[model samples]
Target: MAREGQESPLLKVEGLAISHGDVPITLPLEIVVERGETIAIVGESGSGKSLTARAIVGILPPGINAKGAVTLDGVPLMRLAERELRTIRGSRVSMLMQDPFTMLNPLMRSGDHIDEMLRDRPEFASRAVRADEVKRRLAEVGIVDEDVARRMPFQLSGGMCQRVALAAALARDPELLIADEPSTALDVTTQAEIIKLLRRIQRERNMAVILITHNLRLAFSTCQRIYVLYAGSMLEVGDAAAVERQPFHPYTLGLLLSEPPVDIRVPRLVAIRGSVPRAADVIDSCGFADRCEWAKQICRAGKPSLAARDASRFTACIRQDEIQGELDALRSATLSATPETPRRGGTAGALVHVDALVKTFAGRRGRPICAIRDVSLHIMAGESVGLVGESGSGKTTIGRCLVGLETPTDGDIRINGIAAADFGAMAKADRDRVRRTIQMIFQDPYSTLNPKHSVGQALREALGASAGAPSPAPQERIASLLAEVGLSAAYATRRPASLSGGERQRVAIARALAVKPAILVCDEPVSALDVSVQAQVLNLFRRLQVEHELSYLFITHDLAVVRQIAERIYVLYLGEIVEEGPTERVISNPQHPYTRRLIESIVRSAIQRAP
Candidate 1:
């Protein structure tokens, strides 16, 4: 940490206010970051975490209003002209966005994009020197191969793309780095590697960093200080350890309580009730008052200013004193809920059985690249089976094959004793019946949903297909589906874009359940959601499995999530099942090296968290 009176802060913001269209999103806020310090802005979707980062980059979308003074090294950033800010953007301050695939130019070669940044500099007169520098930067981020750098953006995996983007951000050696959910989409091992890389770079460069994310564990592990944002307001600010040990605000407590336990026998996940309030609904009142269990009459009537709770902690809650006891109780409950014993039973009932599954894709050079080779596994009915792997490990390819979206090169997939190959060549009626027996939930809900259609239309379309026609009153079914997924009925008429990420995901779940399928192939379903929303979705999956006797082929990179729900787990590596056993046994006492690495990564992440 920087001394208080040593020098002026590296970055400072005061009286920051922002709006989207006609609604104010972020209220007047104050924050600062000193050289060699990292600050994490933690919040759920629509909490103004990403918006704040965008505001600093001067890349906020149109119809957004910002009023604040953002200064860097004593120079006012908001006062600078557009051209001036452009000069400072890549050379002085750089941002690493959430999704690297969308951030990178798809048409450009990966190496050329980094070289382009160097070519723009007047000092880089030699092409060979720039090329060497690009390779060195890529190597610095753990990507040492020459072939990866030469490949196009689309040719790389999501993890590889993220590393390329990080290299691009470091091409200019910016003084400040803004990483926004940098590891959200990555597997546990990849996420650990990225976090380690960022920390190493920051230490070596002594660059100030602003880490924005909804994952409290990630933030606490990487950042020294954390700021909790709720409904556009800064609810609390303090040292990460202090905040985690003794959260001062209701919202902060809610966030901490919402994380799912790593232990399998832990029953009853902690959930924060209600959704985040919209910007238009925010007023001069406690942002979390609506969902706060300890909210009082004063909490809803007036806003609370940040008050010093300790030497290093501050909170914006009128009932902080009264809530501390309840927060402590919740924390105790959370700790007690983690069980010492592991779950039993694995590889039974044969809900989904595959043999010699194979899928090959054409590489850039037109050579056949085997994605999955001779992969086989069995998932039991009413059982949760986890598919674990890093990117390019073919977990998703097998998932796609099981869902009938892609044809396997050679293999057999049996769901409920029905072979996938036989089901594929079956008549249209038989195929439709097989499809109705199994449904898939994709990773990107926003892309999966039709933008032009309302929730009702999407649900009705899916159910109508299974029902063979539209029901007499589809509205009630839509409402019931929403309720089944822990969403409000009022959301039935809303468009996909109009809903939060959690809400949109709930709608996706509802669409999958509309067919009354006995099996669900979830591909990273909760990876895009925050920890709170993730817990809710995990519990929902568990409940639906119990109620409907549904079997889940859950494919995810997050082992913590897998531990919570999966009865059995299959560890995939480079298109093969290297290890298979009960979830607890596979995760806790792994025999394969890859499985051991994954377990080590998860333990490292958890242990590195501020205590």
Candidate 2:
């Protein structure tokens, strides 16, 4: 509420509901952003976090219907026409998306992207003026190299592309900036840098920002307030520090526990029991009732309204007062619990060993560039080994080499005491037998999964391709495979497009297990998943490893994630193994400066908050 003559909020959303056709995507929600304030809208995929951001910017996809009163600077945006909204966009509000590469034009130079945003402005009237502004904008984002202006999007790294994207968004000096998962795709160090830069720019410009992300750590580190959404409804809204310290909703608590703490190791991440409900599956009752441990019979009675818990906090839970003590106890118990020490020495001989591995690619101007240089590591049978590095640091390349996706330029890869190259010279059956011992799981399961094929069909194909004798009942085998990865038989009937991100990854895992592989090369498998979903997947990996006698070359950029799953850690920097030791030692006492930076980059939301 504004005073009688005072101006309205810089951005105000009231009773906002979004739907596609007859199915509701998000329930009526409210948000208020004052000038120079930062607020986060946090939730898993399909929880309508991104949809809310899109709605606020008047850029919802076709067939999506948004009903609400959205005002910017006292102007009714929802009532405005497309032409009218176009003028307001970039000038009043700008959006920075998750994938900077997707937003940027690959054919155009970085400077041209910024120039287009400033071309219509009176200040940048001439080409020379616009060019100078472009350089200034790029420099503001930490890209000071003048040559970056001429470089195409493909020429720059992921972090550089993100910086350029931010430059274009800030080109118009919008009063409000909506950054939706802006740092999710980058590495830890790059992610921290981008967020720091965004915060600095926001304060310098006195701009209000709506930071939409699934990461509670990121939200708490960068935002002043957090709004937790579950199954399209806002469950909790409070100060970022207050929410991190004590969540009012069970869903918020689950999210906090789901994140692997860098400072303390827990036995297992407390994953939510089930995946988030789809818009069509959402009912009138509490959306989190199925997964909430404290859910009571009355929780399923009807939808709860967001009620004030305190002067600065709001929660949708009806039993907040009754459950506060228990929730706090659980939180304390989970965080301060005995550390799960890495069990070292209970594994068979090395299953996969790479000695003097070197992989080179043809660089620009026909120059040779080494991707993996003298990298040596071994994964013991039934042991999980982590390969941690930033983007372009040969983490994925090594995973690819281990899975036979790429051949080493100059090195020897021995699998089960036999050279990988020698397997090709052996009999066809022997070669096939050795090949089936290693399987790879990619980051984006959708790209690897066949959209046209059902989960059952994909698993069946993998089963048939293996050299082993045919199963007595292929259907039973497929079901068993699905069960191993925490999916039910019914999931077999669903296509990749119909499943959630976590479910699809489960299907991918089932398919990999279909070959009865001894080693699984997991490459950033849970990087993009929500914290709860990532926890579920990581736990599944640990369970499957013991049950099936599997070894993993877990490749990821996140030390926190790797700490939860890996027994040994190898830190890779610029295609070289800079540090290698036990997971606990590497994390606690990093020998390399690069390794220390990676650990420091982790956003420890459980222990820290925004100042």
Best by TM-score: 2
Query: Per-residue CA lDDT of candidate 2, range 1-611, in tens?
Result: 12135456798899999999889999888998877899999988879999999998899999999998999988999999999999999989999999999889998998999999998888789999999899899999999999999999999999999999999999998999999999999999999999999999999999999999999989998998889987889899998888888899999988888888776567878999888886556558889888899999999898888898777899999999999999988887887779887555355678888899999999989999999999999988788899999999999988877766777788888887767744445577656766799999999999999999999999999998887675758889988998888888998899999998999999999999888899999999999898899999999998888888788989999999998899898999999999998898889899999999998898778542222
Candidate 1 regions exceeding 4 Å error are 1-3, 120-122, 338-349, 364-366, 467-473, 603-611
Off by over 4 Å in 2: 1-7, 345-348, 421-427, 607-611
Model 1 is weakest, by summed lDDT over 10 consecutive residues, at 602-611
Candidate 1 has a TM-score of 0.93
What is the Cα root-mean-square deviation between model 1 and the actual structure? Answer: 2.7
| Model 1, span 399-465: residue lDDT tens | 8888788888888887766667554586786678778888999888999999999998999898887
TM-scores for all candidates: the values are: 0.93, 0.97
User: Against the hidden true structure, what lDDT does model 2 obtain?
Assistant: 0.88
lDDT value, residue 453 of candidate 2: 98
